[model samples]
Target: MHFSSETRRDDGVVERDFTIGEIPGVLWTPEAAPTPVPLVLLGHPGGLRTMRPRLAARARSATRDGLAAATIELPGSGERPRGAKVDAVRAELRQALQTGEPVTPEIVDRLVLPLVEQAVPEWQTCLDALLELPEIGGPVGLSGGVISIGVRLAVVEPRIAAAVLFAGSFVPRVVLEEARRVTVPVHVLLQWDDEGNDRQVALDLFDALGSPEKSLYANLGGHTGVPAFAGEEAARFLARHLR
Candidate 1:
């Protein structure tokens, strides 16, 4: 991992922007923290530029609780080149929405699955670099999501002890099957009336999770309607498991 810049926040947190080969990312650590603090990996909702404020807030919250936090730019996002596959997928997704067609499993598989596949490796690579840092320790946690990558990681990554999933995205049938194997503690958040999402699908996805310690937080309003307190609740959940 090659860090390009490091910033010290007024709140006594240190933020470092880095790149591991083609992947770009940011890591945050509390100032004067002891070595080997617990770490949390944050997943964004696609656009890194727009997502930074929210990501920073969550990182700060984790730091306050003595946990290090980090996020990697998803494939084909940020300064990375928008490859043909991603462009085609974006166009298809937009067309499906514009034509008022529901995003079916087939559609999600074709348009979103590839991105999910690409993202998992990037996140794994980020985790490899993060865990190597002297300031980060074991019992990693995952927070935020569009759903797919979180489910994939939770099922396959043993280092992740807990997850806080933002489940407002479509889930392919294959992903649902894989979700049945995710046994880590998970806290799933759903915006009850999100216009852009299928509420039944979100509920069904939550139901399919095989974790014995899964909890659901469903609230009213659209995608952005997640109340401030919901984040507090998620922080508590991660703290319980990670700390």
Candidate 2:
């Protein structure tokens, strides 16, 4: 990982822009931390530029808790090259949602499964690099982003001590199948009134998880309407596990 730029914020959070291979990413660390700190991988729905503000906010929050945070562009997101096949699949999924049709497992699998396959390794690899930084040490946590990716990482990435999964997107069949193997503590945030999500499936996904220490925070809101306190609670959950 090569950090191309660095800036120290007024709030004492050090922000750096980086690239791992062709993947663009950013890392945030507390400027005056006395000791080495934990790390949190910030997950998103694939648009780094559009999502920067929120990602930065979460990173700053993590830094406030003496933990570093970082995130990279997902496989076809931001300036990364995207394929026609994924674009076509996305269009089909949008059309189905618009037409009020049930999103078939085939559609979800075609769109998200490959993303999970590609992203999980990138995260693991990124963790390898980010942990190399002297300021970020030891355990890691995952926050937000695609729920399926979070579930898969919590299952496969042994370094992930805890996770906060936002159930605002579709949980592919494969993700549900793998959920039972995720043993790390998980805090799932479900927006009960999200227009684009199936509430029942989100609940089922929560029920399917195998984590002995897991909590579901469901509130009446849309996809982007997660209450501020809900976020604080999720951060506390990660802090508890990582500490």
Highest TM-score, which number?
2
Look at candidate 1 and give me any clashing residue pairs.
Answer: none
Model 1, residue 40: C-alpha shift (Å): 0.6
* Displacement of the residue 231 alpha carbon in candidate 2, Å: 0.5
Tens digit per residue, CA lDDT, model 2, 84-184: 88899999999998998988989999998888899999999999999888888968999999999999998888898999999855778878999999999
* Model 2 regions lying over 4 Å from their true place: none
Which lDDT tens digits does candidate 1 get at residues 1-243? 999999998999999999999888889999988668999999987777789999999998899999999998888887878889779877888899999987777888887788888898889989998899889998899998668999999988899999999986577678889999999999999999988888888888899899999999988878988898998999999988998
Q: Give the per-residue Cα lDDT of candidate 2 at 165.
A: 93
| Number of residue pairs clashing in candidate 2, backbone atoms closer than 3 angstroms, sequence gap of 3 or more or interchain | 0
Residue 111, model 1: lDDT of: 72
TM-score of 2: 0.98
Show the lowest summed lDDT stretch of 10 residues, model 1.
Answer: 167-176
The global Cα lDDT (0 to 1) of model 1 is: 0.89
TM-score of each: 0.97, 0.98
Steric clashes per prediction: 0, 0
